[model samples]
Target chain A: MATTNDYLKGTKSVLPILTGLFPFGLIYGVSAVTSGIPKVQAIAMSFVVFAGAAQISIVNSFSSGISIITAVAIAGLINLRMAMYGASIADSIRSDRLLTRIFSSFLLTDQVYAVSITEKGKNMNTNIFKFYIGAALPIWLTWQAATIIGVFAGKTLPSWLSLEFAVPLTFLALLGPFLVKSHFAVSALTAGIVMVLTRNVPYNAGFFIAVLSGITAGFLIKNRKGDR
Target chain B: MNTSHLWAVIILSGIATFIIRFFFIQIKQAPLSGKVKELFSFIPPAVLSALVFGSVFENGLSSLTPRNPYLWASILAGITAVTSKNVLLTISTGMIFIWGWNYLY
Candidate 1:
């Protein structure tokens, strides 16, 4: 059972990540609106798909002459790792209720994973379901509101704002605290270099490739240390 | 191509994604093995770095040249991220730098 304090703490902890998503949400809305799709259909994606990277992938797919099946496939592949996230954190929740698990799964996201997983490690007794909801609801609402604003004011926003940079900056901030260990540094550097080298690969296959190789590289090195 | 196709894509992808999210939570298998769990620990950093570098260099390595305001802002943002370790500060500072630099240059 989650206390009111747990919910408030979760909300407070996620505010920074929500700040980072604000600009990216605006960009998604603007890009989807102008990406040759009808505006209402584009905005509806925020409600249905609710994954920023997948939404961007689908929009790019549409613009590139791909079939809808192909677009869905690409987006699904980009999100395949969410399965890993769900599996990794499955142990944290104490609830056995089917509805609770289903509801919590719906809110599973990169930011929620980052905050909840880290918080889970620090203290084991907290009600993760409530914490997840607190974090997820605010970010979900922000994304919807920002998309609407982006769709309407897409033309009014200045390119000089460099809003696109926020996405990368957000990733960096999430990564910084984890870099103290050489294993983590090795993984991040390998992933980054691989992503750059394979940027030209079509359908963003490079992303999956980089993810696999980078994780393998770090996993191998960490195991090597364990062998000694 | 058509409106139906677009809707199909949205609905299918959403269902596929939710299924993935739901898979492990529903399965009542033995807990993940130790080695597998160790590998999972590396994923967050690996995935986050791949995403950051992918966006920063989306236009290819040539775009990282000093002429690109984003490159400079990224460098400064990286420093702030490491030093401050604060999300809101890192993003706000990076954008402010990019906006100021773009205006002046």
Candidate 2:
């Protein structure tokens, strides 16, 4: 069972991450509306889809020449790693009831998973499921509120805001942490260059190519270092 | 796509994503080797870089020019992210620079 302290700790731990999400959510809301996604659905997608990167990219896939199947594939591919997080934390919740697992799985996300996994290392026998919930619920609420606000605030904002830069900047912030790791750095560089070169590929196949090449480069580099 | 079609896309894709999240958690046997599991770890960085690079350099060589404050904003953002390691700090730095650049020039 999760005590009040654990839940509070989870909430307090997530405060910094919450501040970061506000802009991303606002940007997603603003962008999704203009990307041919209906305003209402855009708000709905926040809580429904709940994955920011996948949600933004899926909305991008809606452009002409990209098939619906392709859109669906993009969503699946982007989120495949969620299962990895699911598996990583599975040991902690092995004995929980099905309903508990289902609810927990619904809220599983990168930030929540990161906090829960890090906490796991510090304390044994912690109720991670409750911690996960405490962390996830606030994120969910913040995202939805921001997205809704963005949807309504769409187009009314000043033209000088350059809202277009918000997403990339946010992503850059996320990618920045991995730069110190040689293998990860090389992987990011490989993907970045590949993406730029393949930008014009039909149906945005560049995304798949870039990601694959990055992972391959990172894996190979890591393997070589291990062998030597 | 019509509203209905878009709705279908949203609901279907949402379901597919949820299934992926639920698969390993719901099942008892979500086994993997050390090597394969490590590969999964590379996914986020790779994906984040792809998205960021593709967006920042969206216009190919055109975006590399000095007028593109996004490029500059990204540099500041990258530095803030690594040094501060605070997501909010990095975002604020980037947002402030890009927005400020827009008005100043």
Candidate 3:
């Protein structure tokens, strides 16, 4: 498998994406502290939860009156997207040791999923497990490290950076090339519209609904074209 | 919440998230069939669109207009991505656009 080479390649491919990530880590760290969350929990969540979006959202929504179950439910629902990522990459990384698959799955995130899928699309002959490990490790380290720094720094950051915008922008960059494909574009558009329509849906089930709508639209469109 | 309570939330949330990420991988088989694989390909666009649009409209539809720097910045960012096809450029453009917009008013 040339595990080392494949791993390094995975690392190299995802480094550029981290530019946007570093700021997010900082924001999460600073925001957690600013929100008057205990420093221990702030650090602990970053270390254990390891899911950036979920961690930040959970922290943002937290109040002394909020119950543990409600907090966990929020985290779980926000992270429900991971299930799809896990299922998608399962076949590719299934050849690895069970331990490796388990650990790599824990490290999965939007950036890692995006990177892994792009690598898969190129039909790279690389070892998928090693590549996934490579892709995931850097993000894990960068997030933990940046978060600690931000938490300790504890200074209110200037709002002008708009680093949060970088999140959607990064997704746009990753999603750009694919938009050229008609089916993908239609699917994306359909999903975006549904997302807007479902903004007020309870419990953020809107994500699930939009995803289902987009996938169905794309699949149907592709099949309809095939029958021609 | 107290420290113990916070810890409970953190640890339990972590465990729950890990299980979600691990569930499918733990049970998966290799060499997926064509139909399943094809369905998989649509996931990114759908998920990304859902996510991107989620953030884009984070302030709700009333904020969909240009006055919402996030909205306009994202639009310009989309253009940059489509034309430049460069992640760094696209991100820089988007963030910079928002910063500038916010700075002015």
For each candidate in turn, the TM-score is 0.72, 0.87, 0.68
Error at B65, model 1, angstroms: 3.1
Model 2 lDDT tens row, A1-228: 444577777888899988878877888887677655778899878867899888876666664436677777767777888989888888775556888777888888899999999989987767876777889899888999999988888667665776656667767777788888899999989998998888888777888899999999999999999952
* Residue B78 lDDT (model 2): 89
> Which candidate number would show the highest lDDT if scored against the true structure?
2
User: Candidate 1: misplaced stretches above 4 Å?
Assistant: A1-42, A52-85, A88-100, A110-139, A201-203, B1-9
| Interface RMSD of predicted model 2 | 2.2
Candidate lDDT (C-alpha), each: 0.77, 0.81, 0.77
**What docking class should model 3 receive?**
medium
Best by TM-score: 2
**Clash number for model 2?**
0
**Would you list the rank order by lDDT, best first?**
2, 3, 1
Question: What class would a CAPRI assessor give candidate 1's docking?
Answer: medium
lDDT for residue A158 in candidate 1, whole number 0-100: 66
- Which is the winner by TM-score between candidate 1 and candidate 3? 1
Off by over 4 Å in 2: A1-9, A34-36, A62-65, B1-5, B61-63
